[model samples]
Each structure stands twice: as structure tokens, then as C-alpha cells.
Target: MKTRKKANFFPRFHKLFAVKKIFSLLFAGGAAGAVNGLFGGGGGMIALPALERAGYPVRAAHATALAVVLPASLVSAAVYFFGGVPLAVLLPVSLGVTAGGLLGAALLPRLREGLLSVLFSLLMFAAGIRMLLP
Candidate 1:
């Protein structure tokens, strides 16, 4: 009987952190944090690809990106709160986001990799085009 070595899905995480890779990851994370702080969104756009390039599988990368961005999002929200952005204005949007997140989580496991990639690309492209428009 032949035995196959189990693949390490996050190889970069398992090994000793190299200085170059550490800098690259930090740069990516810093950029994502800055974007989140400035725009109140879009951090996942920068983090997902960075994590994927660092050897995470697409699903793992997406999940990890959420974890990575959560703290930044919280801090950004805190700033907005202190800046007197009305909590009532955010309440409805927050409810919708929570519902959508539940639906997305339920669908993620059943989604095909190709379909997910195409959807993600289209979303990013649409966001870019929208941002570019007057």
C-alpha cells in the first residue's frame, strides 16, 4: 500500500516566517487596513489575493480574509461612531449585511471553485468601474 503525504493547505504559515515574505504579508495587510479605514470597505479585495498568493486555497483564503479584516472593520466602525455617524443610519444596513452573510455562508460550501472565481472577478471589476465613474 502506498501512502501519500498530507498536503499542508497553508504552507507559509507552517514554516518559519522569512523576512521577505513577512514584509510582503505586512505590506498587504497594511494596505488592506488603510483601504478599510479610508473607504469603510474593500479590505477583502487586497487581502484575499495576497493570502491566495501566500499559498492558501481559495476557500481557506476567503475565510482567512474575513478573519483578517474583522479587526480593522471594528476599528473603522469605532472611529465613525466617535465621529458621530448616527448608529440608527447603520442599523438597517447592518441587519441586511448579517442576513446576507448567513446566506453566503450557507451557499459557500456548495459553490464551485470556477463559479466563485468568476463571481469574485466580476464583483471587483464592477466595483472598479463604479469607482471610476463620475
Candidate 2:
């Protein structure tokens, strides 16, 4: 059996630090964490940009977002598990999404650069329109 090597910095945060910065990290982590748990997809999208604006390096921001997401994902999964959600329905969708996400990630590097921007903008516009609908 081939042992897979541990990948480094798939998500990492290496930055300068201070006492006050701990609070910032905690706050960023918590806010992003909750968004991830509550809404699912928008947390990373919002967190990365917001963290960049707040002076974190892009890589660090992503790492922070991932850090937050890890716990939230676990908790959400736990809640679903304990809440008597039918595993039959959840299992197929979870597997489908996991497989689809893997394929998307693999194909990501080969895709057009502006595609994400256009898609995100459209989603935001659609959401705004949805909000305005009577």
C-alpha cells in the first residue's frame, strides 16, 4: 500500500502576531465559522475578501477561514446526525456532493479565470433580485 505524504500549506496561516491580534483571529474565525455553519457556501467567499481588507495575507485569511470551517462542519454534521435525519437521503447527497466537489477542484486550475467572478456576481444579483421580489 502506498502511503500518501502529508500535504503542507493546503491551508496555512503564517503571519506576525500580537496580543490584540489574538482577538482579531478569534473574531474572524468565529464570524466566518458561524456563517459557514449557518449558510454553508458563502463563508469562505465573504471571509477571504473581508480578511484581506482587514490586513491579513490572502493565504492566511484562507487558512483562518478553513480553521473556522473545520469545527463548524463537524458540529453541523453532528447536529444532523443527532437530529434523526435519515441517513439514506443524506448519504447519497453527501457522496454526490463530495464527488462533484472533488471533480470541480481537480478541474479548477484548467478553467477560465473570470468564470468565478462572473458566477459570483450573478449569484449576488440573483439573490438581490430574490430579496426584492414580492
Candidate 3:
């Protein structure tokens, strides 16, 4: 009979901070930040998959991607503000995004993993198509 080794949470967690892992994470984060800064959004298009590839579970990946992008988004918004992008133009979309974020958070836990994965893939596909079209 083959025996499976028990997973140790601390060791697994500690391994996440190893030098190579840290370098990979930094590279991914830099790419996401650059994309966000250049495009005004879409950091998650890079971040979520990066996090997943780094061994985060789907839910954790999504949550961590949000955390990773928030500061980049904030900095980009600040730059836009300095560049005189009008607040009036942003207010409505910001409000909608805030509401949608709240709703999505409330629903995330109840969503099936398969459904979430499919939806995420569809979103990425749509974004890629849109980018390629114009």
C-alpha cells in the first residue's frame, strides 16, 4: 500500500517566501502593475492567473489578485487625477464597480468551482478578443 505524506501548513507557507518564489512573485506583480498603469485596468487579467500558477487555490487567487491590484489601481488613479482625467466621467462607473464588487463578494462563496473557472476563462477570452479587435 502506498502512503501519502501529510501536508504541513507552516512549511508549505514558508516555502512561498523562498528567494526564487519571491523573485517570481515580484516579476509577476511588476508586470501586472505595468499593465494596470498603462491601460488603467486589467491587472487582474495578469494577476489572477499568476497567483493560481503560484499554487493558490481559486478563491485565494481571486482574493489575492484583488489585494495585489488595489494599490496599483490606486496609484494609477492618482496619476490620472494629476493628468486631469475628469472625476465626473469616473463617478458613475466607480459607483457601479463598487456595487458589483460587493455583490460578487457576497456570492463568491456559494458559486461552484467549475462554474467560477468557466466564467473566469470566458472573461479572459472576451478581453483578449476585444483587445485584438481594435
Decoy 3 TM-score against native: 0.68
What is the C-alpha local distance difference test score of each model? 0.87, 0.70, 0.85
> In model 3, which regions exceed 4 Å deviation?
1-16
Rank list by lDDT: 1, 3, 2
Candidate 1 wrongly placed segments (more than 4 Å): 1-15
Instruction: Work out how many backbone clashes candidate 1 has.
Output: 0
User: Could you give candidate 1's per-residue lDDT for residues 1-134 as a string of tens digits?
Assistant: 12222225435654656556678899999999999999989999999999998888988999999999999999998998898866687899889999999999899789897988899999999989999999
Best by TM-score: 1
Instruction: List all candidate RMSDs to the true structure.
Output: 8.1, 11.9, 6.8
lDDT score of residue 134 within candidate 3: 59
Clashing residue pairs found in predicted model 1: none
Better of 1 and 2 by lDDT: 1
Index of the highest-lDDT prediction? 1
lDDT of 1: 0.87
Give the Cα RMSD of candidate 1.
8.1
Worst 10 residues of 2 by lDDT: 1-10
